[model samples]
Target chain A: MTEAQEKNIPDVSSDFEPKIVAFCCHYCSYAAADLAGSMRLDYPTNIKILKIPCTGKVDVLYLLRAFEDGADGVIVAGCEEGTCHFINGNIKAKKKVKYTKKILDDIGLGGDRLEMYNLSAAMGQKFADLAKEMTERIKKLGPSPVNSGA
Target chain B: MIVGEQKPIEEISKMIAEYKTVLVMGCNTCIAVCHAGGEKEVGILASALRIKNKVEGREQNIEEASMERQCEREFVDELADKIKEADCVLSLACGVGPQTIVEFYPDTIVLPGINTTFYGMPKEQGFFVEFCGGCGNCVLDMTAGICPIVRCSKSMLNGPCGGSQEGRCEVNKDIDCGWQLIHDRLKAQGKLDFMDEILPPKDWSPARHGGPRKMVREDLKIDEKPEDEIEGITKEGEK
Candidate 1:
């Protein structure tokens, strides 16, 4: 935990800035991100948010398109369980995320790069933390193997 | 409806590896309802192949197309233009789809993306269970509408294969014994005496043992009658 030990740890290819696409539901996760911005919370800048009517509206095609277009990681963010603006939309989104993750794994894209999260609109700090976490995780994983050589 | 599952991505990718431009075709009927192959699934699969090719450093082109029902000639004809352009076709319908395409266009290579499993009905959302064997001679009438040919583990014609334990089949406890279902249904309908009528051994000729079979309905024939049939009809008219 010392500064000397932290300094000794080799950093991942520093020049490698991951491109993450996040599909955020307008009712919750999108508003949470907005609140984080207004609250002056700091988070990674690598994530590009695409606000959808609901996480249920986040089609598997969109997630695949992000990877096809060189996104290193993808996230589907929706309202917390039982609070989806469209009842059960978040649950459906979670199932879709799981299915899409399996597709990524089948196609050798590393399912770990895709994830689903749930949060209320008031959870600005949590939203910021997720962004920072996803960025760090993706950085450790390096570039998406699908487009790495391209 | 015919139910099928998509083949593994590895196998499908390998099948199209030699081809530069592969068309991924989907059927919007049975396979679509089962979520095996549909318009949406075609796009997903095409995208997956493109990503896989990129990862493997292969420059393969994958195209997507769909048909309302791949088994019919009219629906299969819709892909005439796309079929001519692609090096090969990867049909996501049941086994019939690719075969139909192969029959219509013998010069083109048609590959099956899904494995045709069985004639089944959706038991629930996302779950399909086999229900029919298409034995040519239907025995559902005598069996209280239950198909013992397919529903029974051993296809017993007379009764349960003496392996019926309680109401479940001996092959699997989860499966309800086919004979048991028949007995229950017949008993409920006051037709229990039908079970003791001693049915005869099925004529295997009508089944698949007769080789590939075709059903022709003279009443539904749209084309001209055969020469022999026409001559017979003319003689009858003259008489």
Candidate 2:
């Protein structure tokens, strides 16, 4: 940290901790998370993973509720294209995520807070990389405005 | 069924901005089936409105209620008590629901949350196509059950318009030429001879051109006196 920049950091920002929610599909992204753990790969601890049958099961309501409940960011992780165990669950999820992004933008949460990522069960390193990437993006964006005190 | 869609959230929010207490009323019948205004949709909208209010730092109270059919008086009566508590009612039913609520509660402000697009059935899941014009005339027998008044872009009665190209509508490439569909249907039934028959000009008096239409059945009308009042003398004679 630069000496001048480090000295001016507000106490609130120094203590600011982002809360991220991940909706992971059981057949792919969830298993990938498991693989990441088995490999002892490091990922941000702020991310809370919720295991779902498929990313298609992630309702727009659920994503909205996460933000309403003070989530700083949300990630819907599903199987890669053409490899969804449920035929097209991941494909459907991508559409839902795109739709939810519009809603977020409409409601002033800035859309960037929600994203959809796809990975295979064997991509442990990719999962770790996404976790760190999402965390940094959210940290730069700061806490969700939806969670800001009214 | 009546097909309608929810108004954009921005539009709805702007409507209820001045009101502190807003009630979102949903209809369980037509709008529900169309995925527009239903119980679940009401909840979603109510939440969205609350979130919008929070983001804007506006103190607002939003409530939700759903009725079986918003067009009927009895079903609308169910919201009587709740209606009194609200400053404005945001009706999520088709256009009829808001009108019904307005008639029942003339003093209250009732807002429309949907634009009633058409009287149609679900062509497929999440898709609706207009099929009936309610022109107060029935000519399905002559057209093999197709109503050209609704299906045809030009409402052509006799035959396909020359503008039709390859069985597709000239106006919209995605739309099938309504006359082409009629021709295929009539051909399948071996009723191609009907194609040569000339149809008379349609009488549009029963349509909206005659202003709002009302159908009254004399047999269905009740007498001025109740059944008990009329039958009282007969019951005494029997006794």
**Tens digit of lDDT per residue, candidate 1, span B1-239?**
99999899999988888999999999999999888899988998898888888877788889999999999878988778898899999999998898878767777799989998999999898888889998888988899999998889999898877889999998999998999999999999999998998889888788799998777788887867885785465444221
Sort candidate 1 into its docking category.
Answer: medium
Q: Give the alpha carbon lDDT tens digit for every residue of A1-150 in model 1.
A: 656336643247567788999999999999999999999999989989999999988888888888988999998999999998899989988888898899898887779999999999999999999999999999887777666553
Model 1 chain B lDDT-worst window of ten: B230-239
* Least well predicted 10-residue stretch by lDDT in candidate 2 chain B: B230-239
Off by over 4 Å in 2: A1-14, B218-239
Clashes of each: 0, 0
lDDT per residue as tens, model 2, B1-239: 88889888899989999998999999999899998899978877787777667767788899999999999878988888898799999999998898877776777799999989998999898779999988888888899998888888999898699988899988899988888999999999999898999999988998989998777565786866665664564344221
* A66-107: candidate 2 lDDT, tens digit per residue: 887789899999999999889999888888788778877777
Two-chain DockQ for model 1: 0.54
lDDT of 2 at B20: 86
Q: Which pairs in model 1 have colliding backbones? A: none
